[model samples]
Target: MEVLRIILTQSSANYKKEETILNKMTYPLPPFSTVIGAIHGACGYKEYHKMDISIQGKYDAMHKEPYRDYCFLNSIGEGDRGTLVKLNNKNFLSTGFDKVAEAKKQQGSSFREGTTIQVMNQELLTEYRELKDLLDRIKDFEENRVDKVLKLIKKRKKDLADKKKKVKENKEALNVVLIREKQIKELEKNINDRIKAYKVNEYEIPYSNFAILTTSLKYYEVLNNIELIIHIKSDKETLMDIKDNIYNLKSIGRSEDFVDIKDASIVEVVDTIDGPITSEYSAYIDYNLIKNECVFLKLGDKITANGTKYYINKDYVIEDNKRIFNKKKVVYTSEYVAEEGSENLHFDISSEKSYIVNFN
Candidate 1:
């Protein structure tokens, strides 16, 4: 069978494991789904394409990198804490926010009173304080004036209903009372609409520009000098597209994990071989292949070598507006051997290349 063989390299990368939180952990290699997604992205395919991949790679070293994590609060309350920021755009959290001030003391530091706080940007601080004052005024108006008017309207409606009951004996006068009650209801609705417009424009819209954000230090596990050998098995058209746009494959693990394409070619490979072939690089081997003895793990005096079992993600289908991934169960190891007449293992037949392909 002819398969697309790609050799790639990255200076630094973090193929993050999904379960990790504070310290973003990195996988031994990029998962199956990551490689597939990267390939589709490079080709600029809008939809998922059917393909199977074999990922094997090595990294020079591993290290922990530090970064700051920011968590923004949904709404500010009395005695607010954390760093105060003025958002460049309303109602969206992006890199477009300017730091107005931060609490010098973690607790009991007031952003509004400017107590024990450092003002980074005086203009933004003034803007934030003005917005806060406007919000307070809006709240006071709603409670003292708008709400009182609504209560008076309700009481007037009740009084009209009482007057209608008293004039029940006179049909014409009762009809007039009902008409006046209807007019009062219409006036109340207009007042409510006006109040809503006032609050949305004066309070909610302006308040969205200011946010209280908290920060924490976190670390990421980064792999350095990554070398990856990927094999792609798909239709002829898709393979040709990838080969044509091989250089467009930018990153695999993260946006910062930029890739450099070394080689891209079609190579003939055979599932059955006449002699033993051992893996030269660490690879994700199908667990079923290991279970059936198609691939053996033996090195030096160790007859039974063990490897880390990973349920690596491959493809995914969107169900209920969320992606449900198809995971492949594989064993990650460098010490794997494939002997004569193997079912799942493949040996590259290229005269200049020697590779043991274990597609999971």
Candidate 2:
């Protein structure tokens, strides 16, 4: 004969209430077979009350031993309002209801019999929380670091601009000095020519004995002194070689001057060549990948591809299986590839995913 058991755990307040509702003073430790019969009777009563089924076939099936094991009573809730129901075994097919009920009954008396040990340490939880807080602070610090770097870059740019302005002013002042020196040299030549012409007129004085020549004639003094006494001035100046020397010093400084700047066209050409070119302007190009071969193009160069020489412009198109190069578009299919022995240039080609080629 089959049996159904409803084992109620004492841990639940519902068990006490169900005992009260059933008019059972205590939880009687009934046999599994007896519980099974009670469950079937309860199901029959429920079905009859609902008018869904008559009691005629209910008890008829109840006598069948094979169907008895299929019945179950699931008690849920607490107090006197706890539930009692008779369910078909088909509803609990996958649930292993018979085995569950047997296990529940076996565990019923021993539910609270085991010793309890403290497994969760408060100190460990506190340490974990501290670690999490530290990580959060680290993330915030990194975000602040980015702002600091940006501010530093802005300050650096301002400083560079000021330095550049100073350098330009210095250069202009030096150029003015050079122009004054050039005029002085021309005036000195004119004065020497006038002295020679007067000497040829045959005065008893050798040109060298003339007081103007006897004194180490300072060019500036010759003009100013002569003008003060005779109101006649030689249009002459001095310090031409000294001014040239100063200009040379300034040129040396210019060579040493370094400034950071950007030029789009040069950058584009550098990118196109996949390396740095020796142009009038200084620039840097970086590549992410290595490549075996690259095609060099100049302005208006016709590239023969697919049996046609394609006349390429500033916005020409070049395509390989890995990359598509359009005027303003650069798409890398893999790491930047540079030809062997071309270590001066590197390409950026870190993306492994495929990309589509299109340009506006």
- Which has the greatest TM-score? 1
- On residues 15-77, what C-alpha lDDT tens digit does candidate 1 reach at each position? 999999988999989999889988999999998889989889889999999999988888877
Worst 10 residues of 1 by lDDT: 297-306
Q: What shift in Å separates residue 141 of candidate 1 from its native position after superposition? A: 3.0
lDDT of each: 0.86, 0.23
The local lDDT score (0 to 100) that residue 177 gets in candidate 1 is: 95
Report model 1's TM-score to 2 decimal places. Answer: 0.84
Candidate No. with top lDDT: 1
lDDT of 2 by residue, 21-123 (tens): 2122211111112222232343332321111000000000111011111222232211211111212243343333111111122222211121121213344
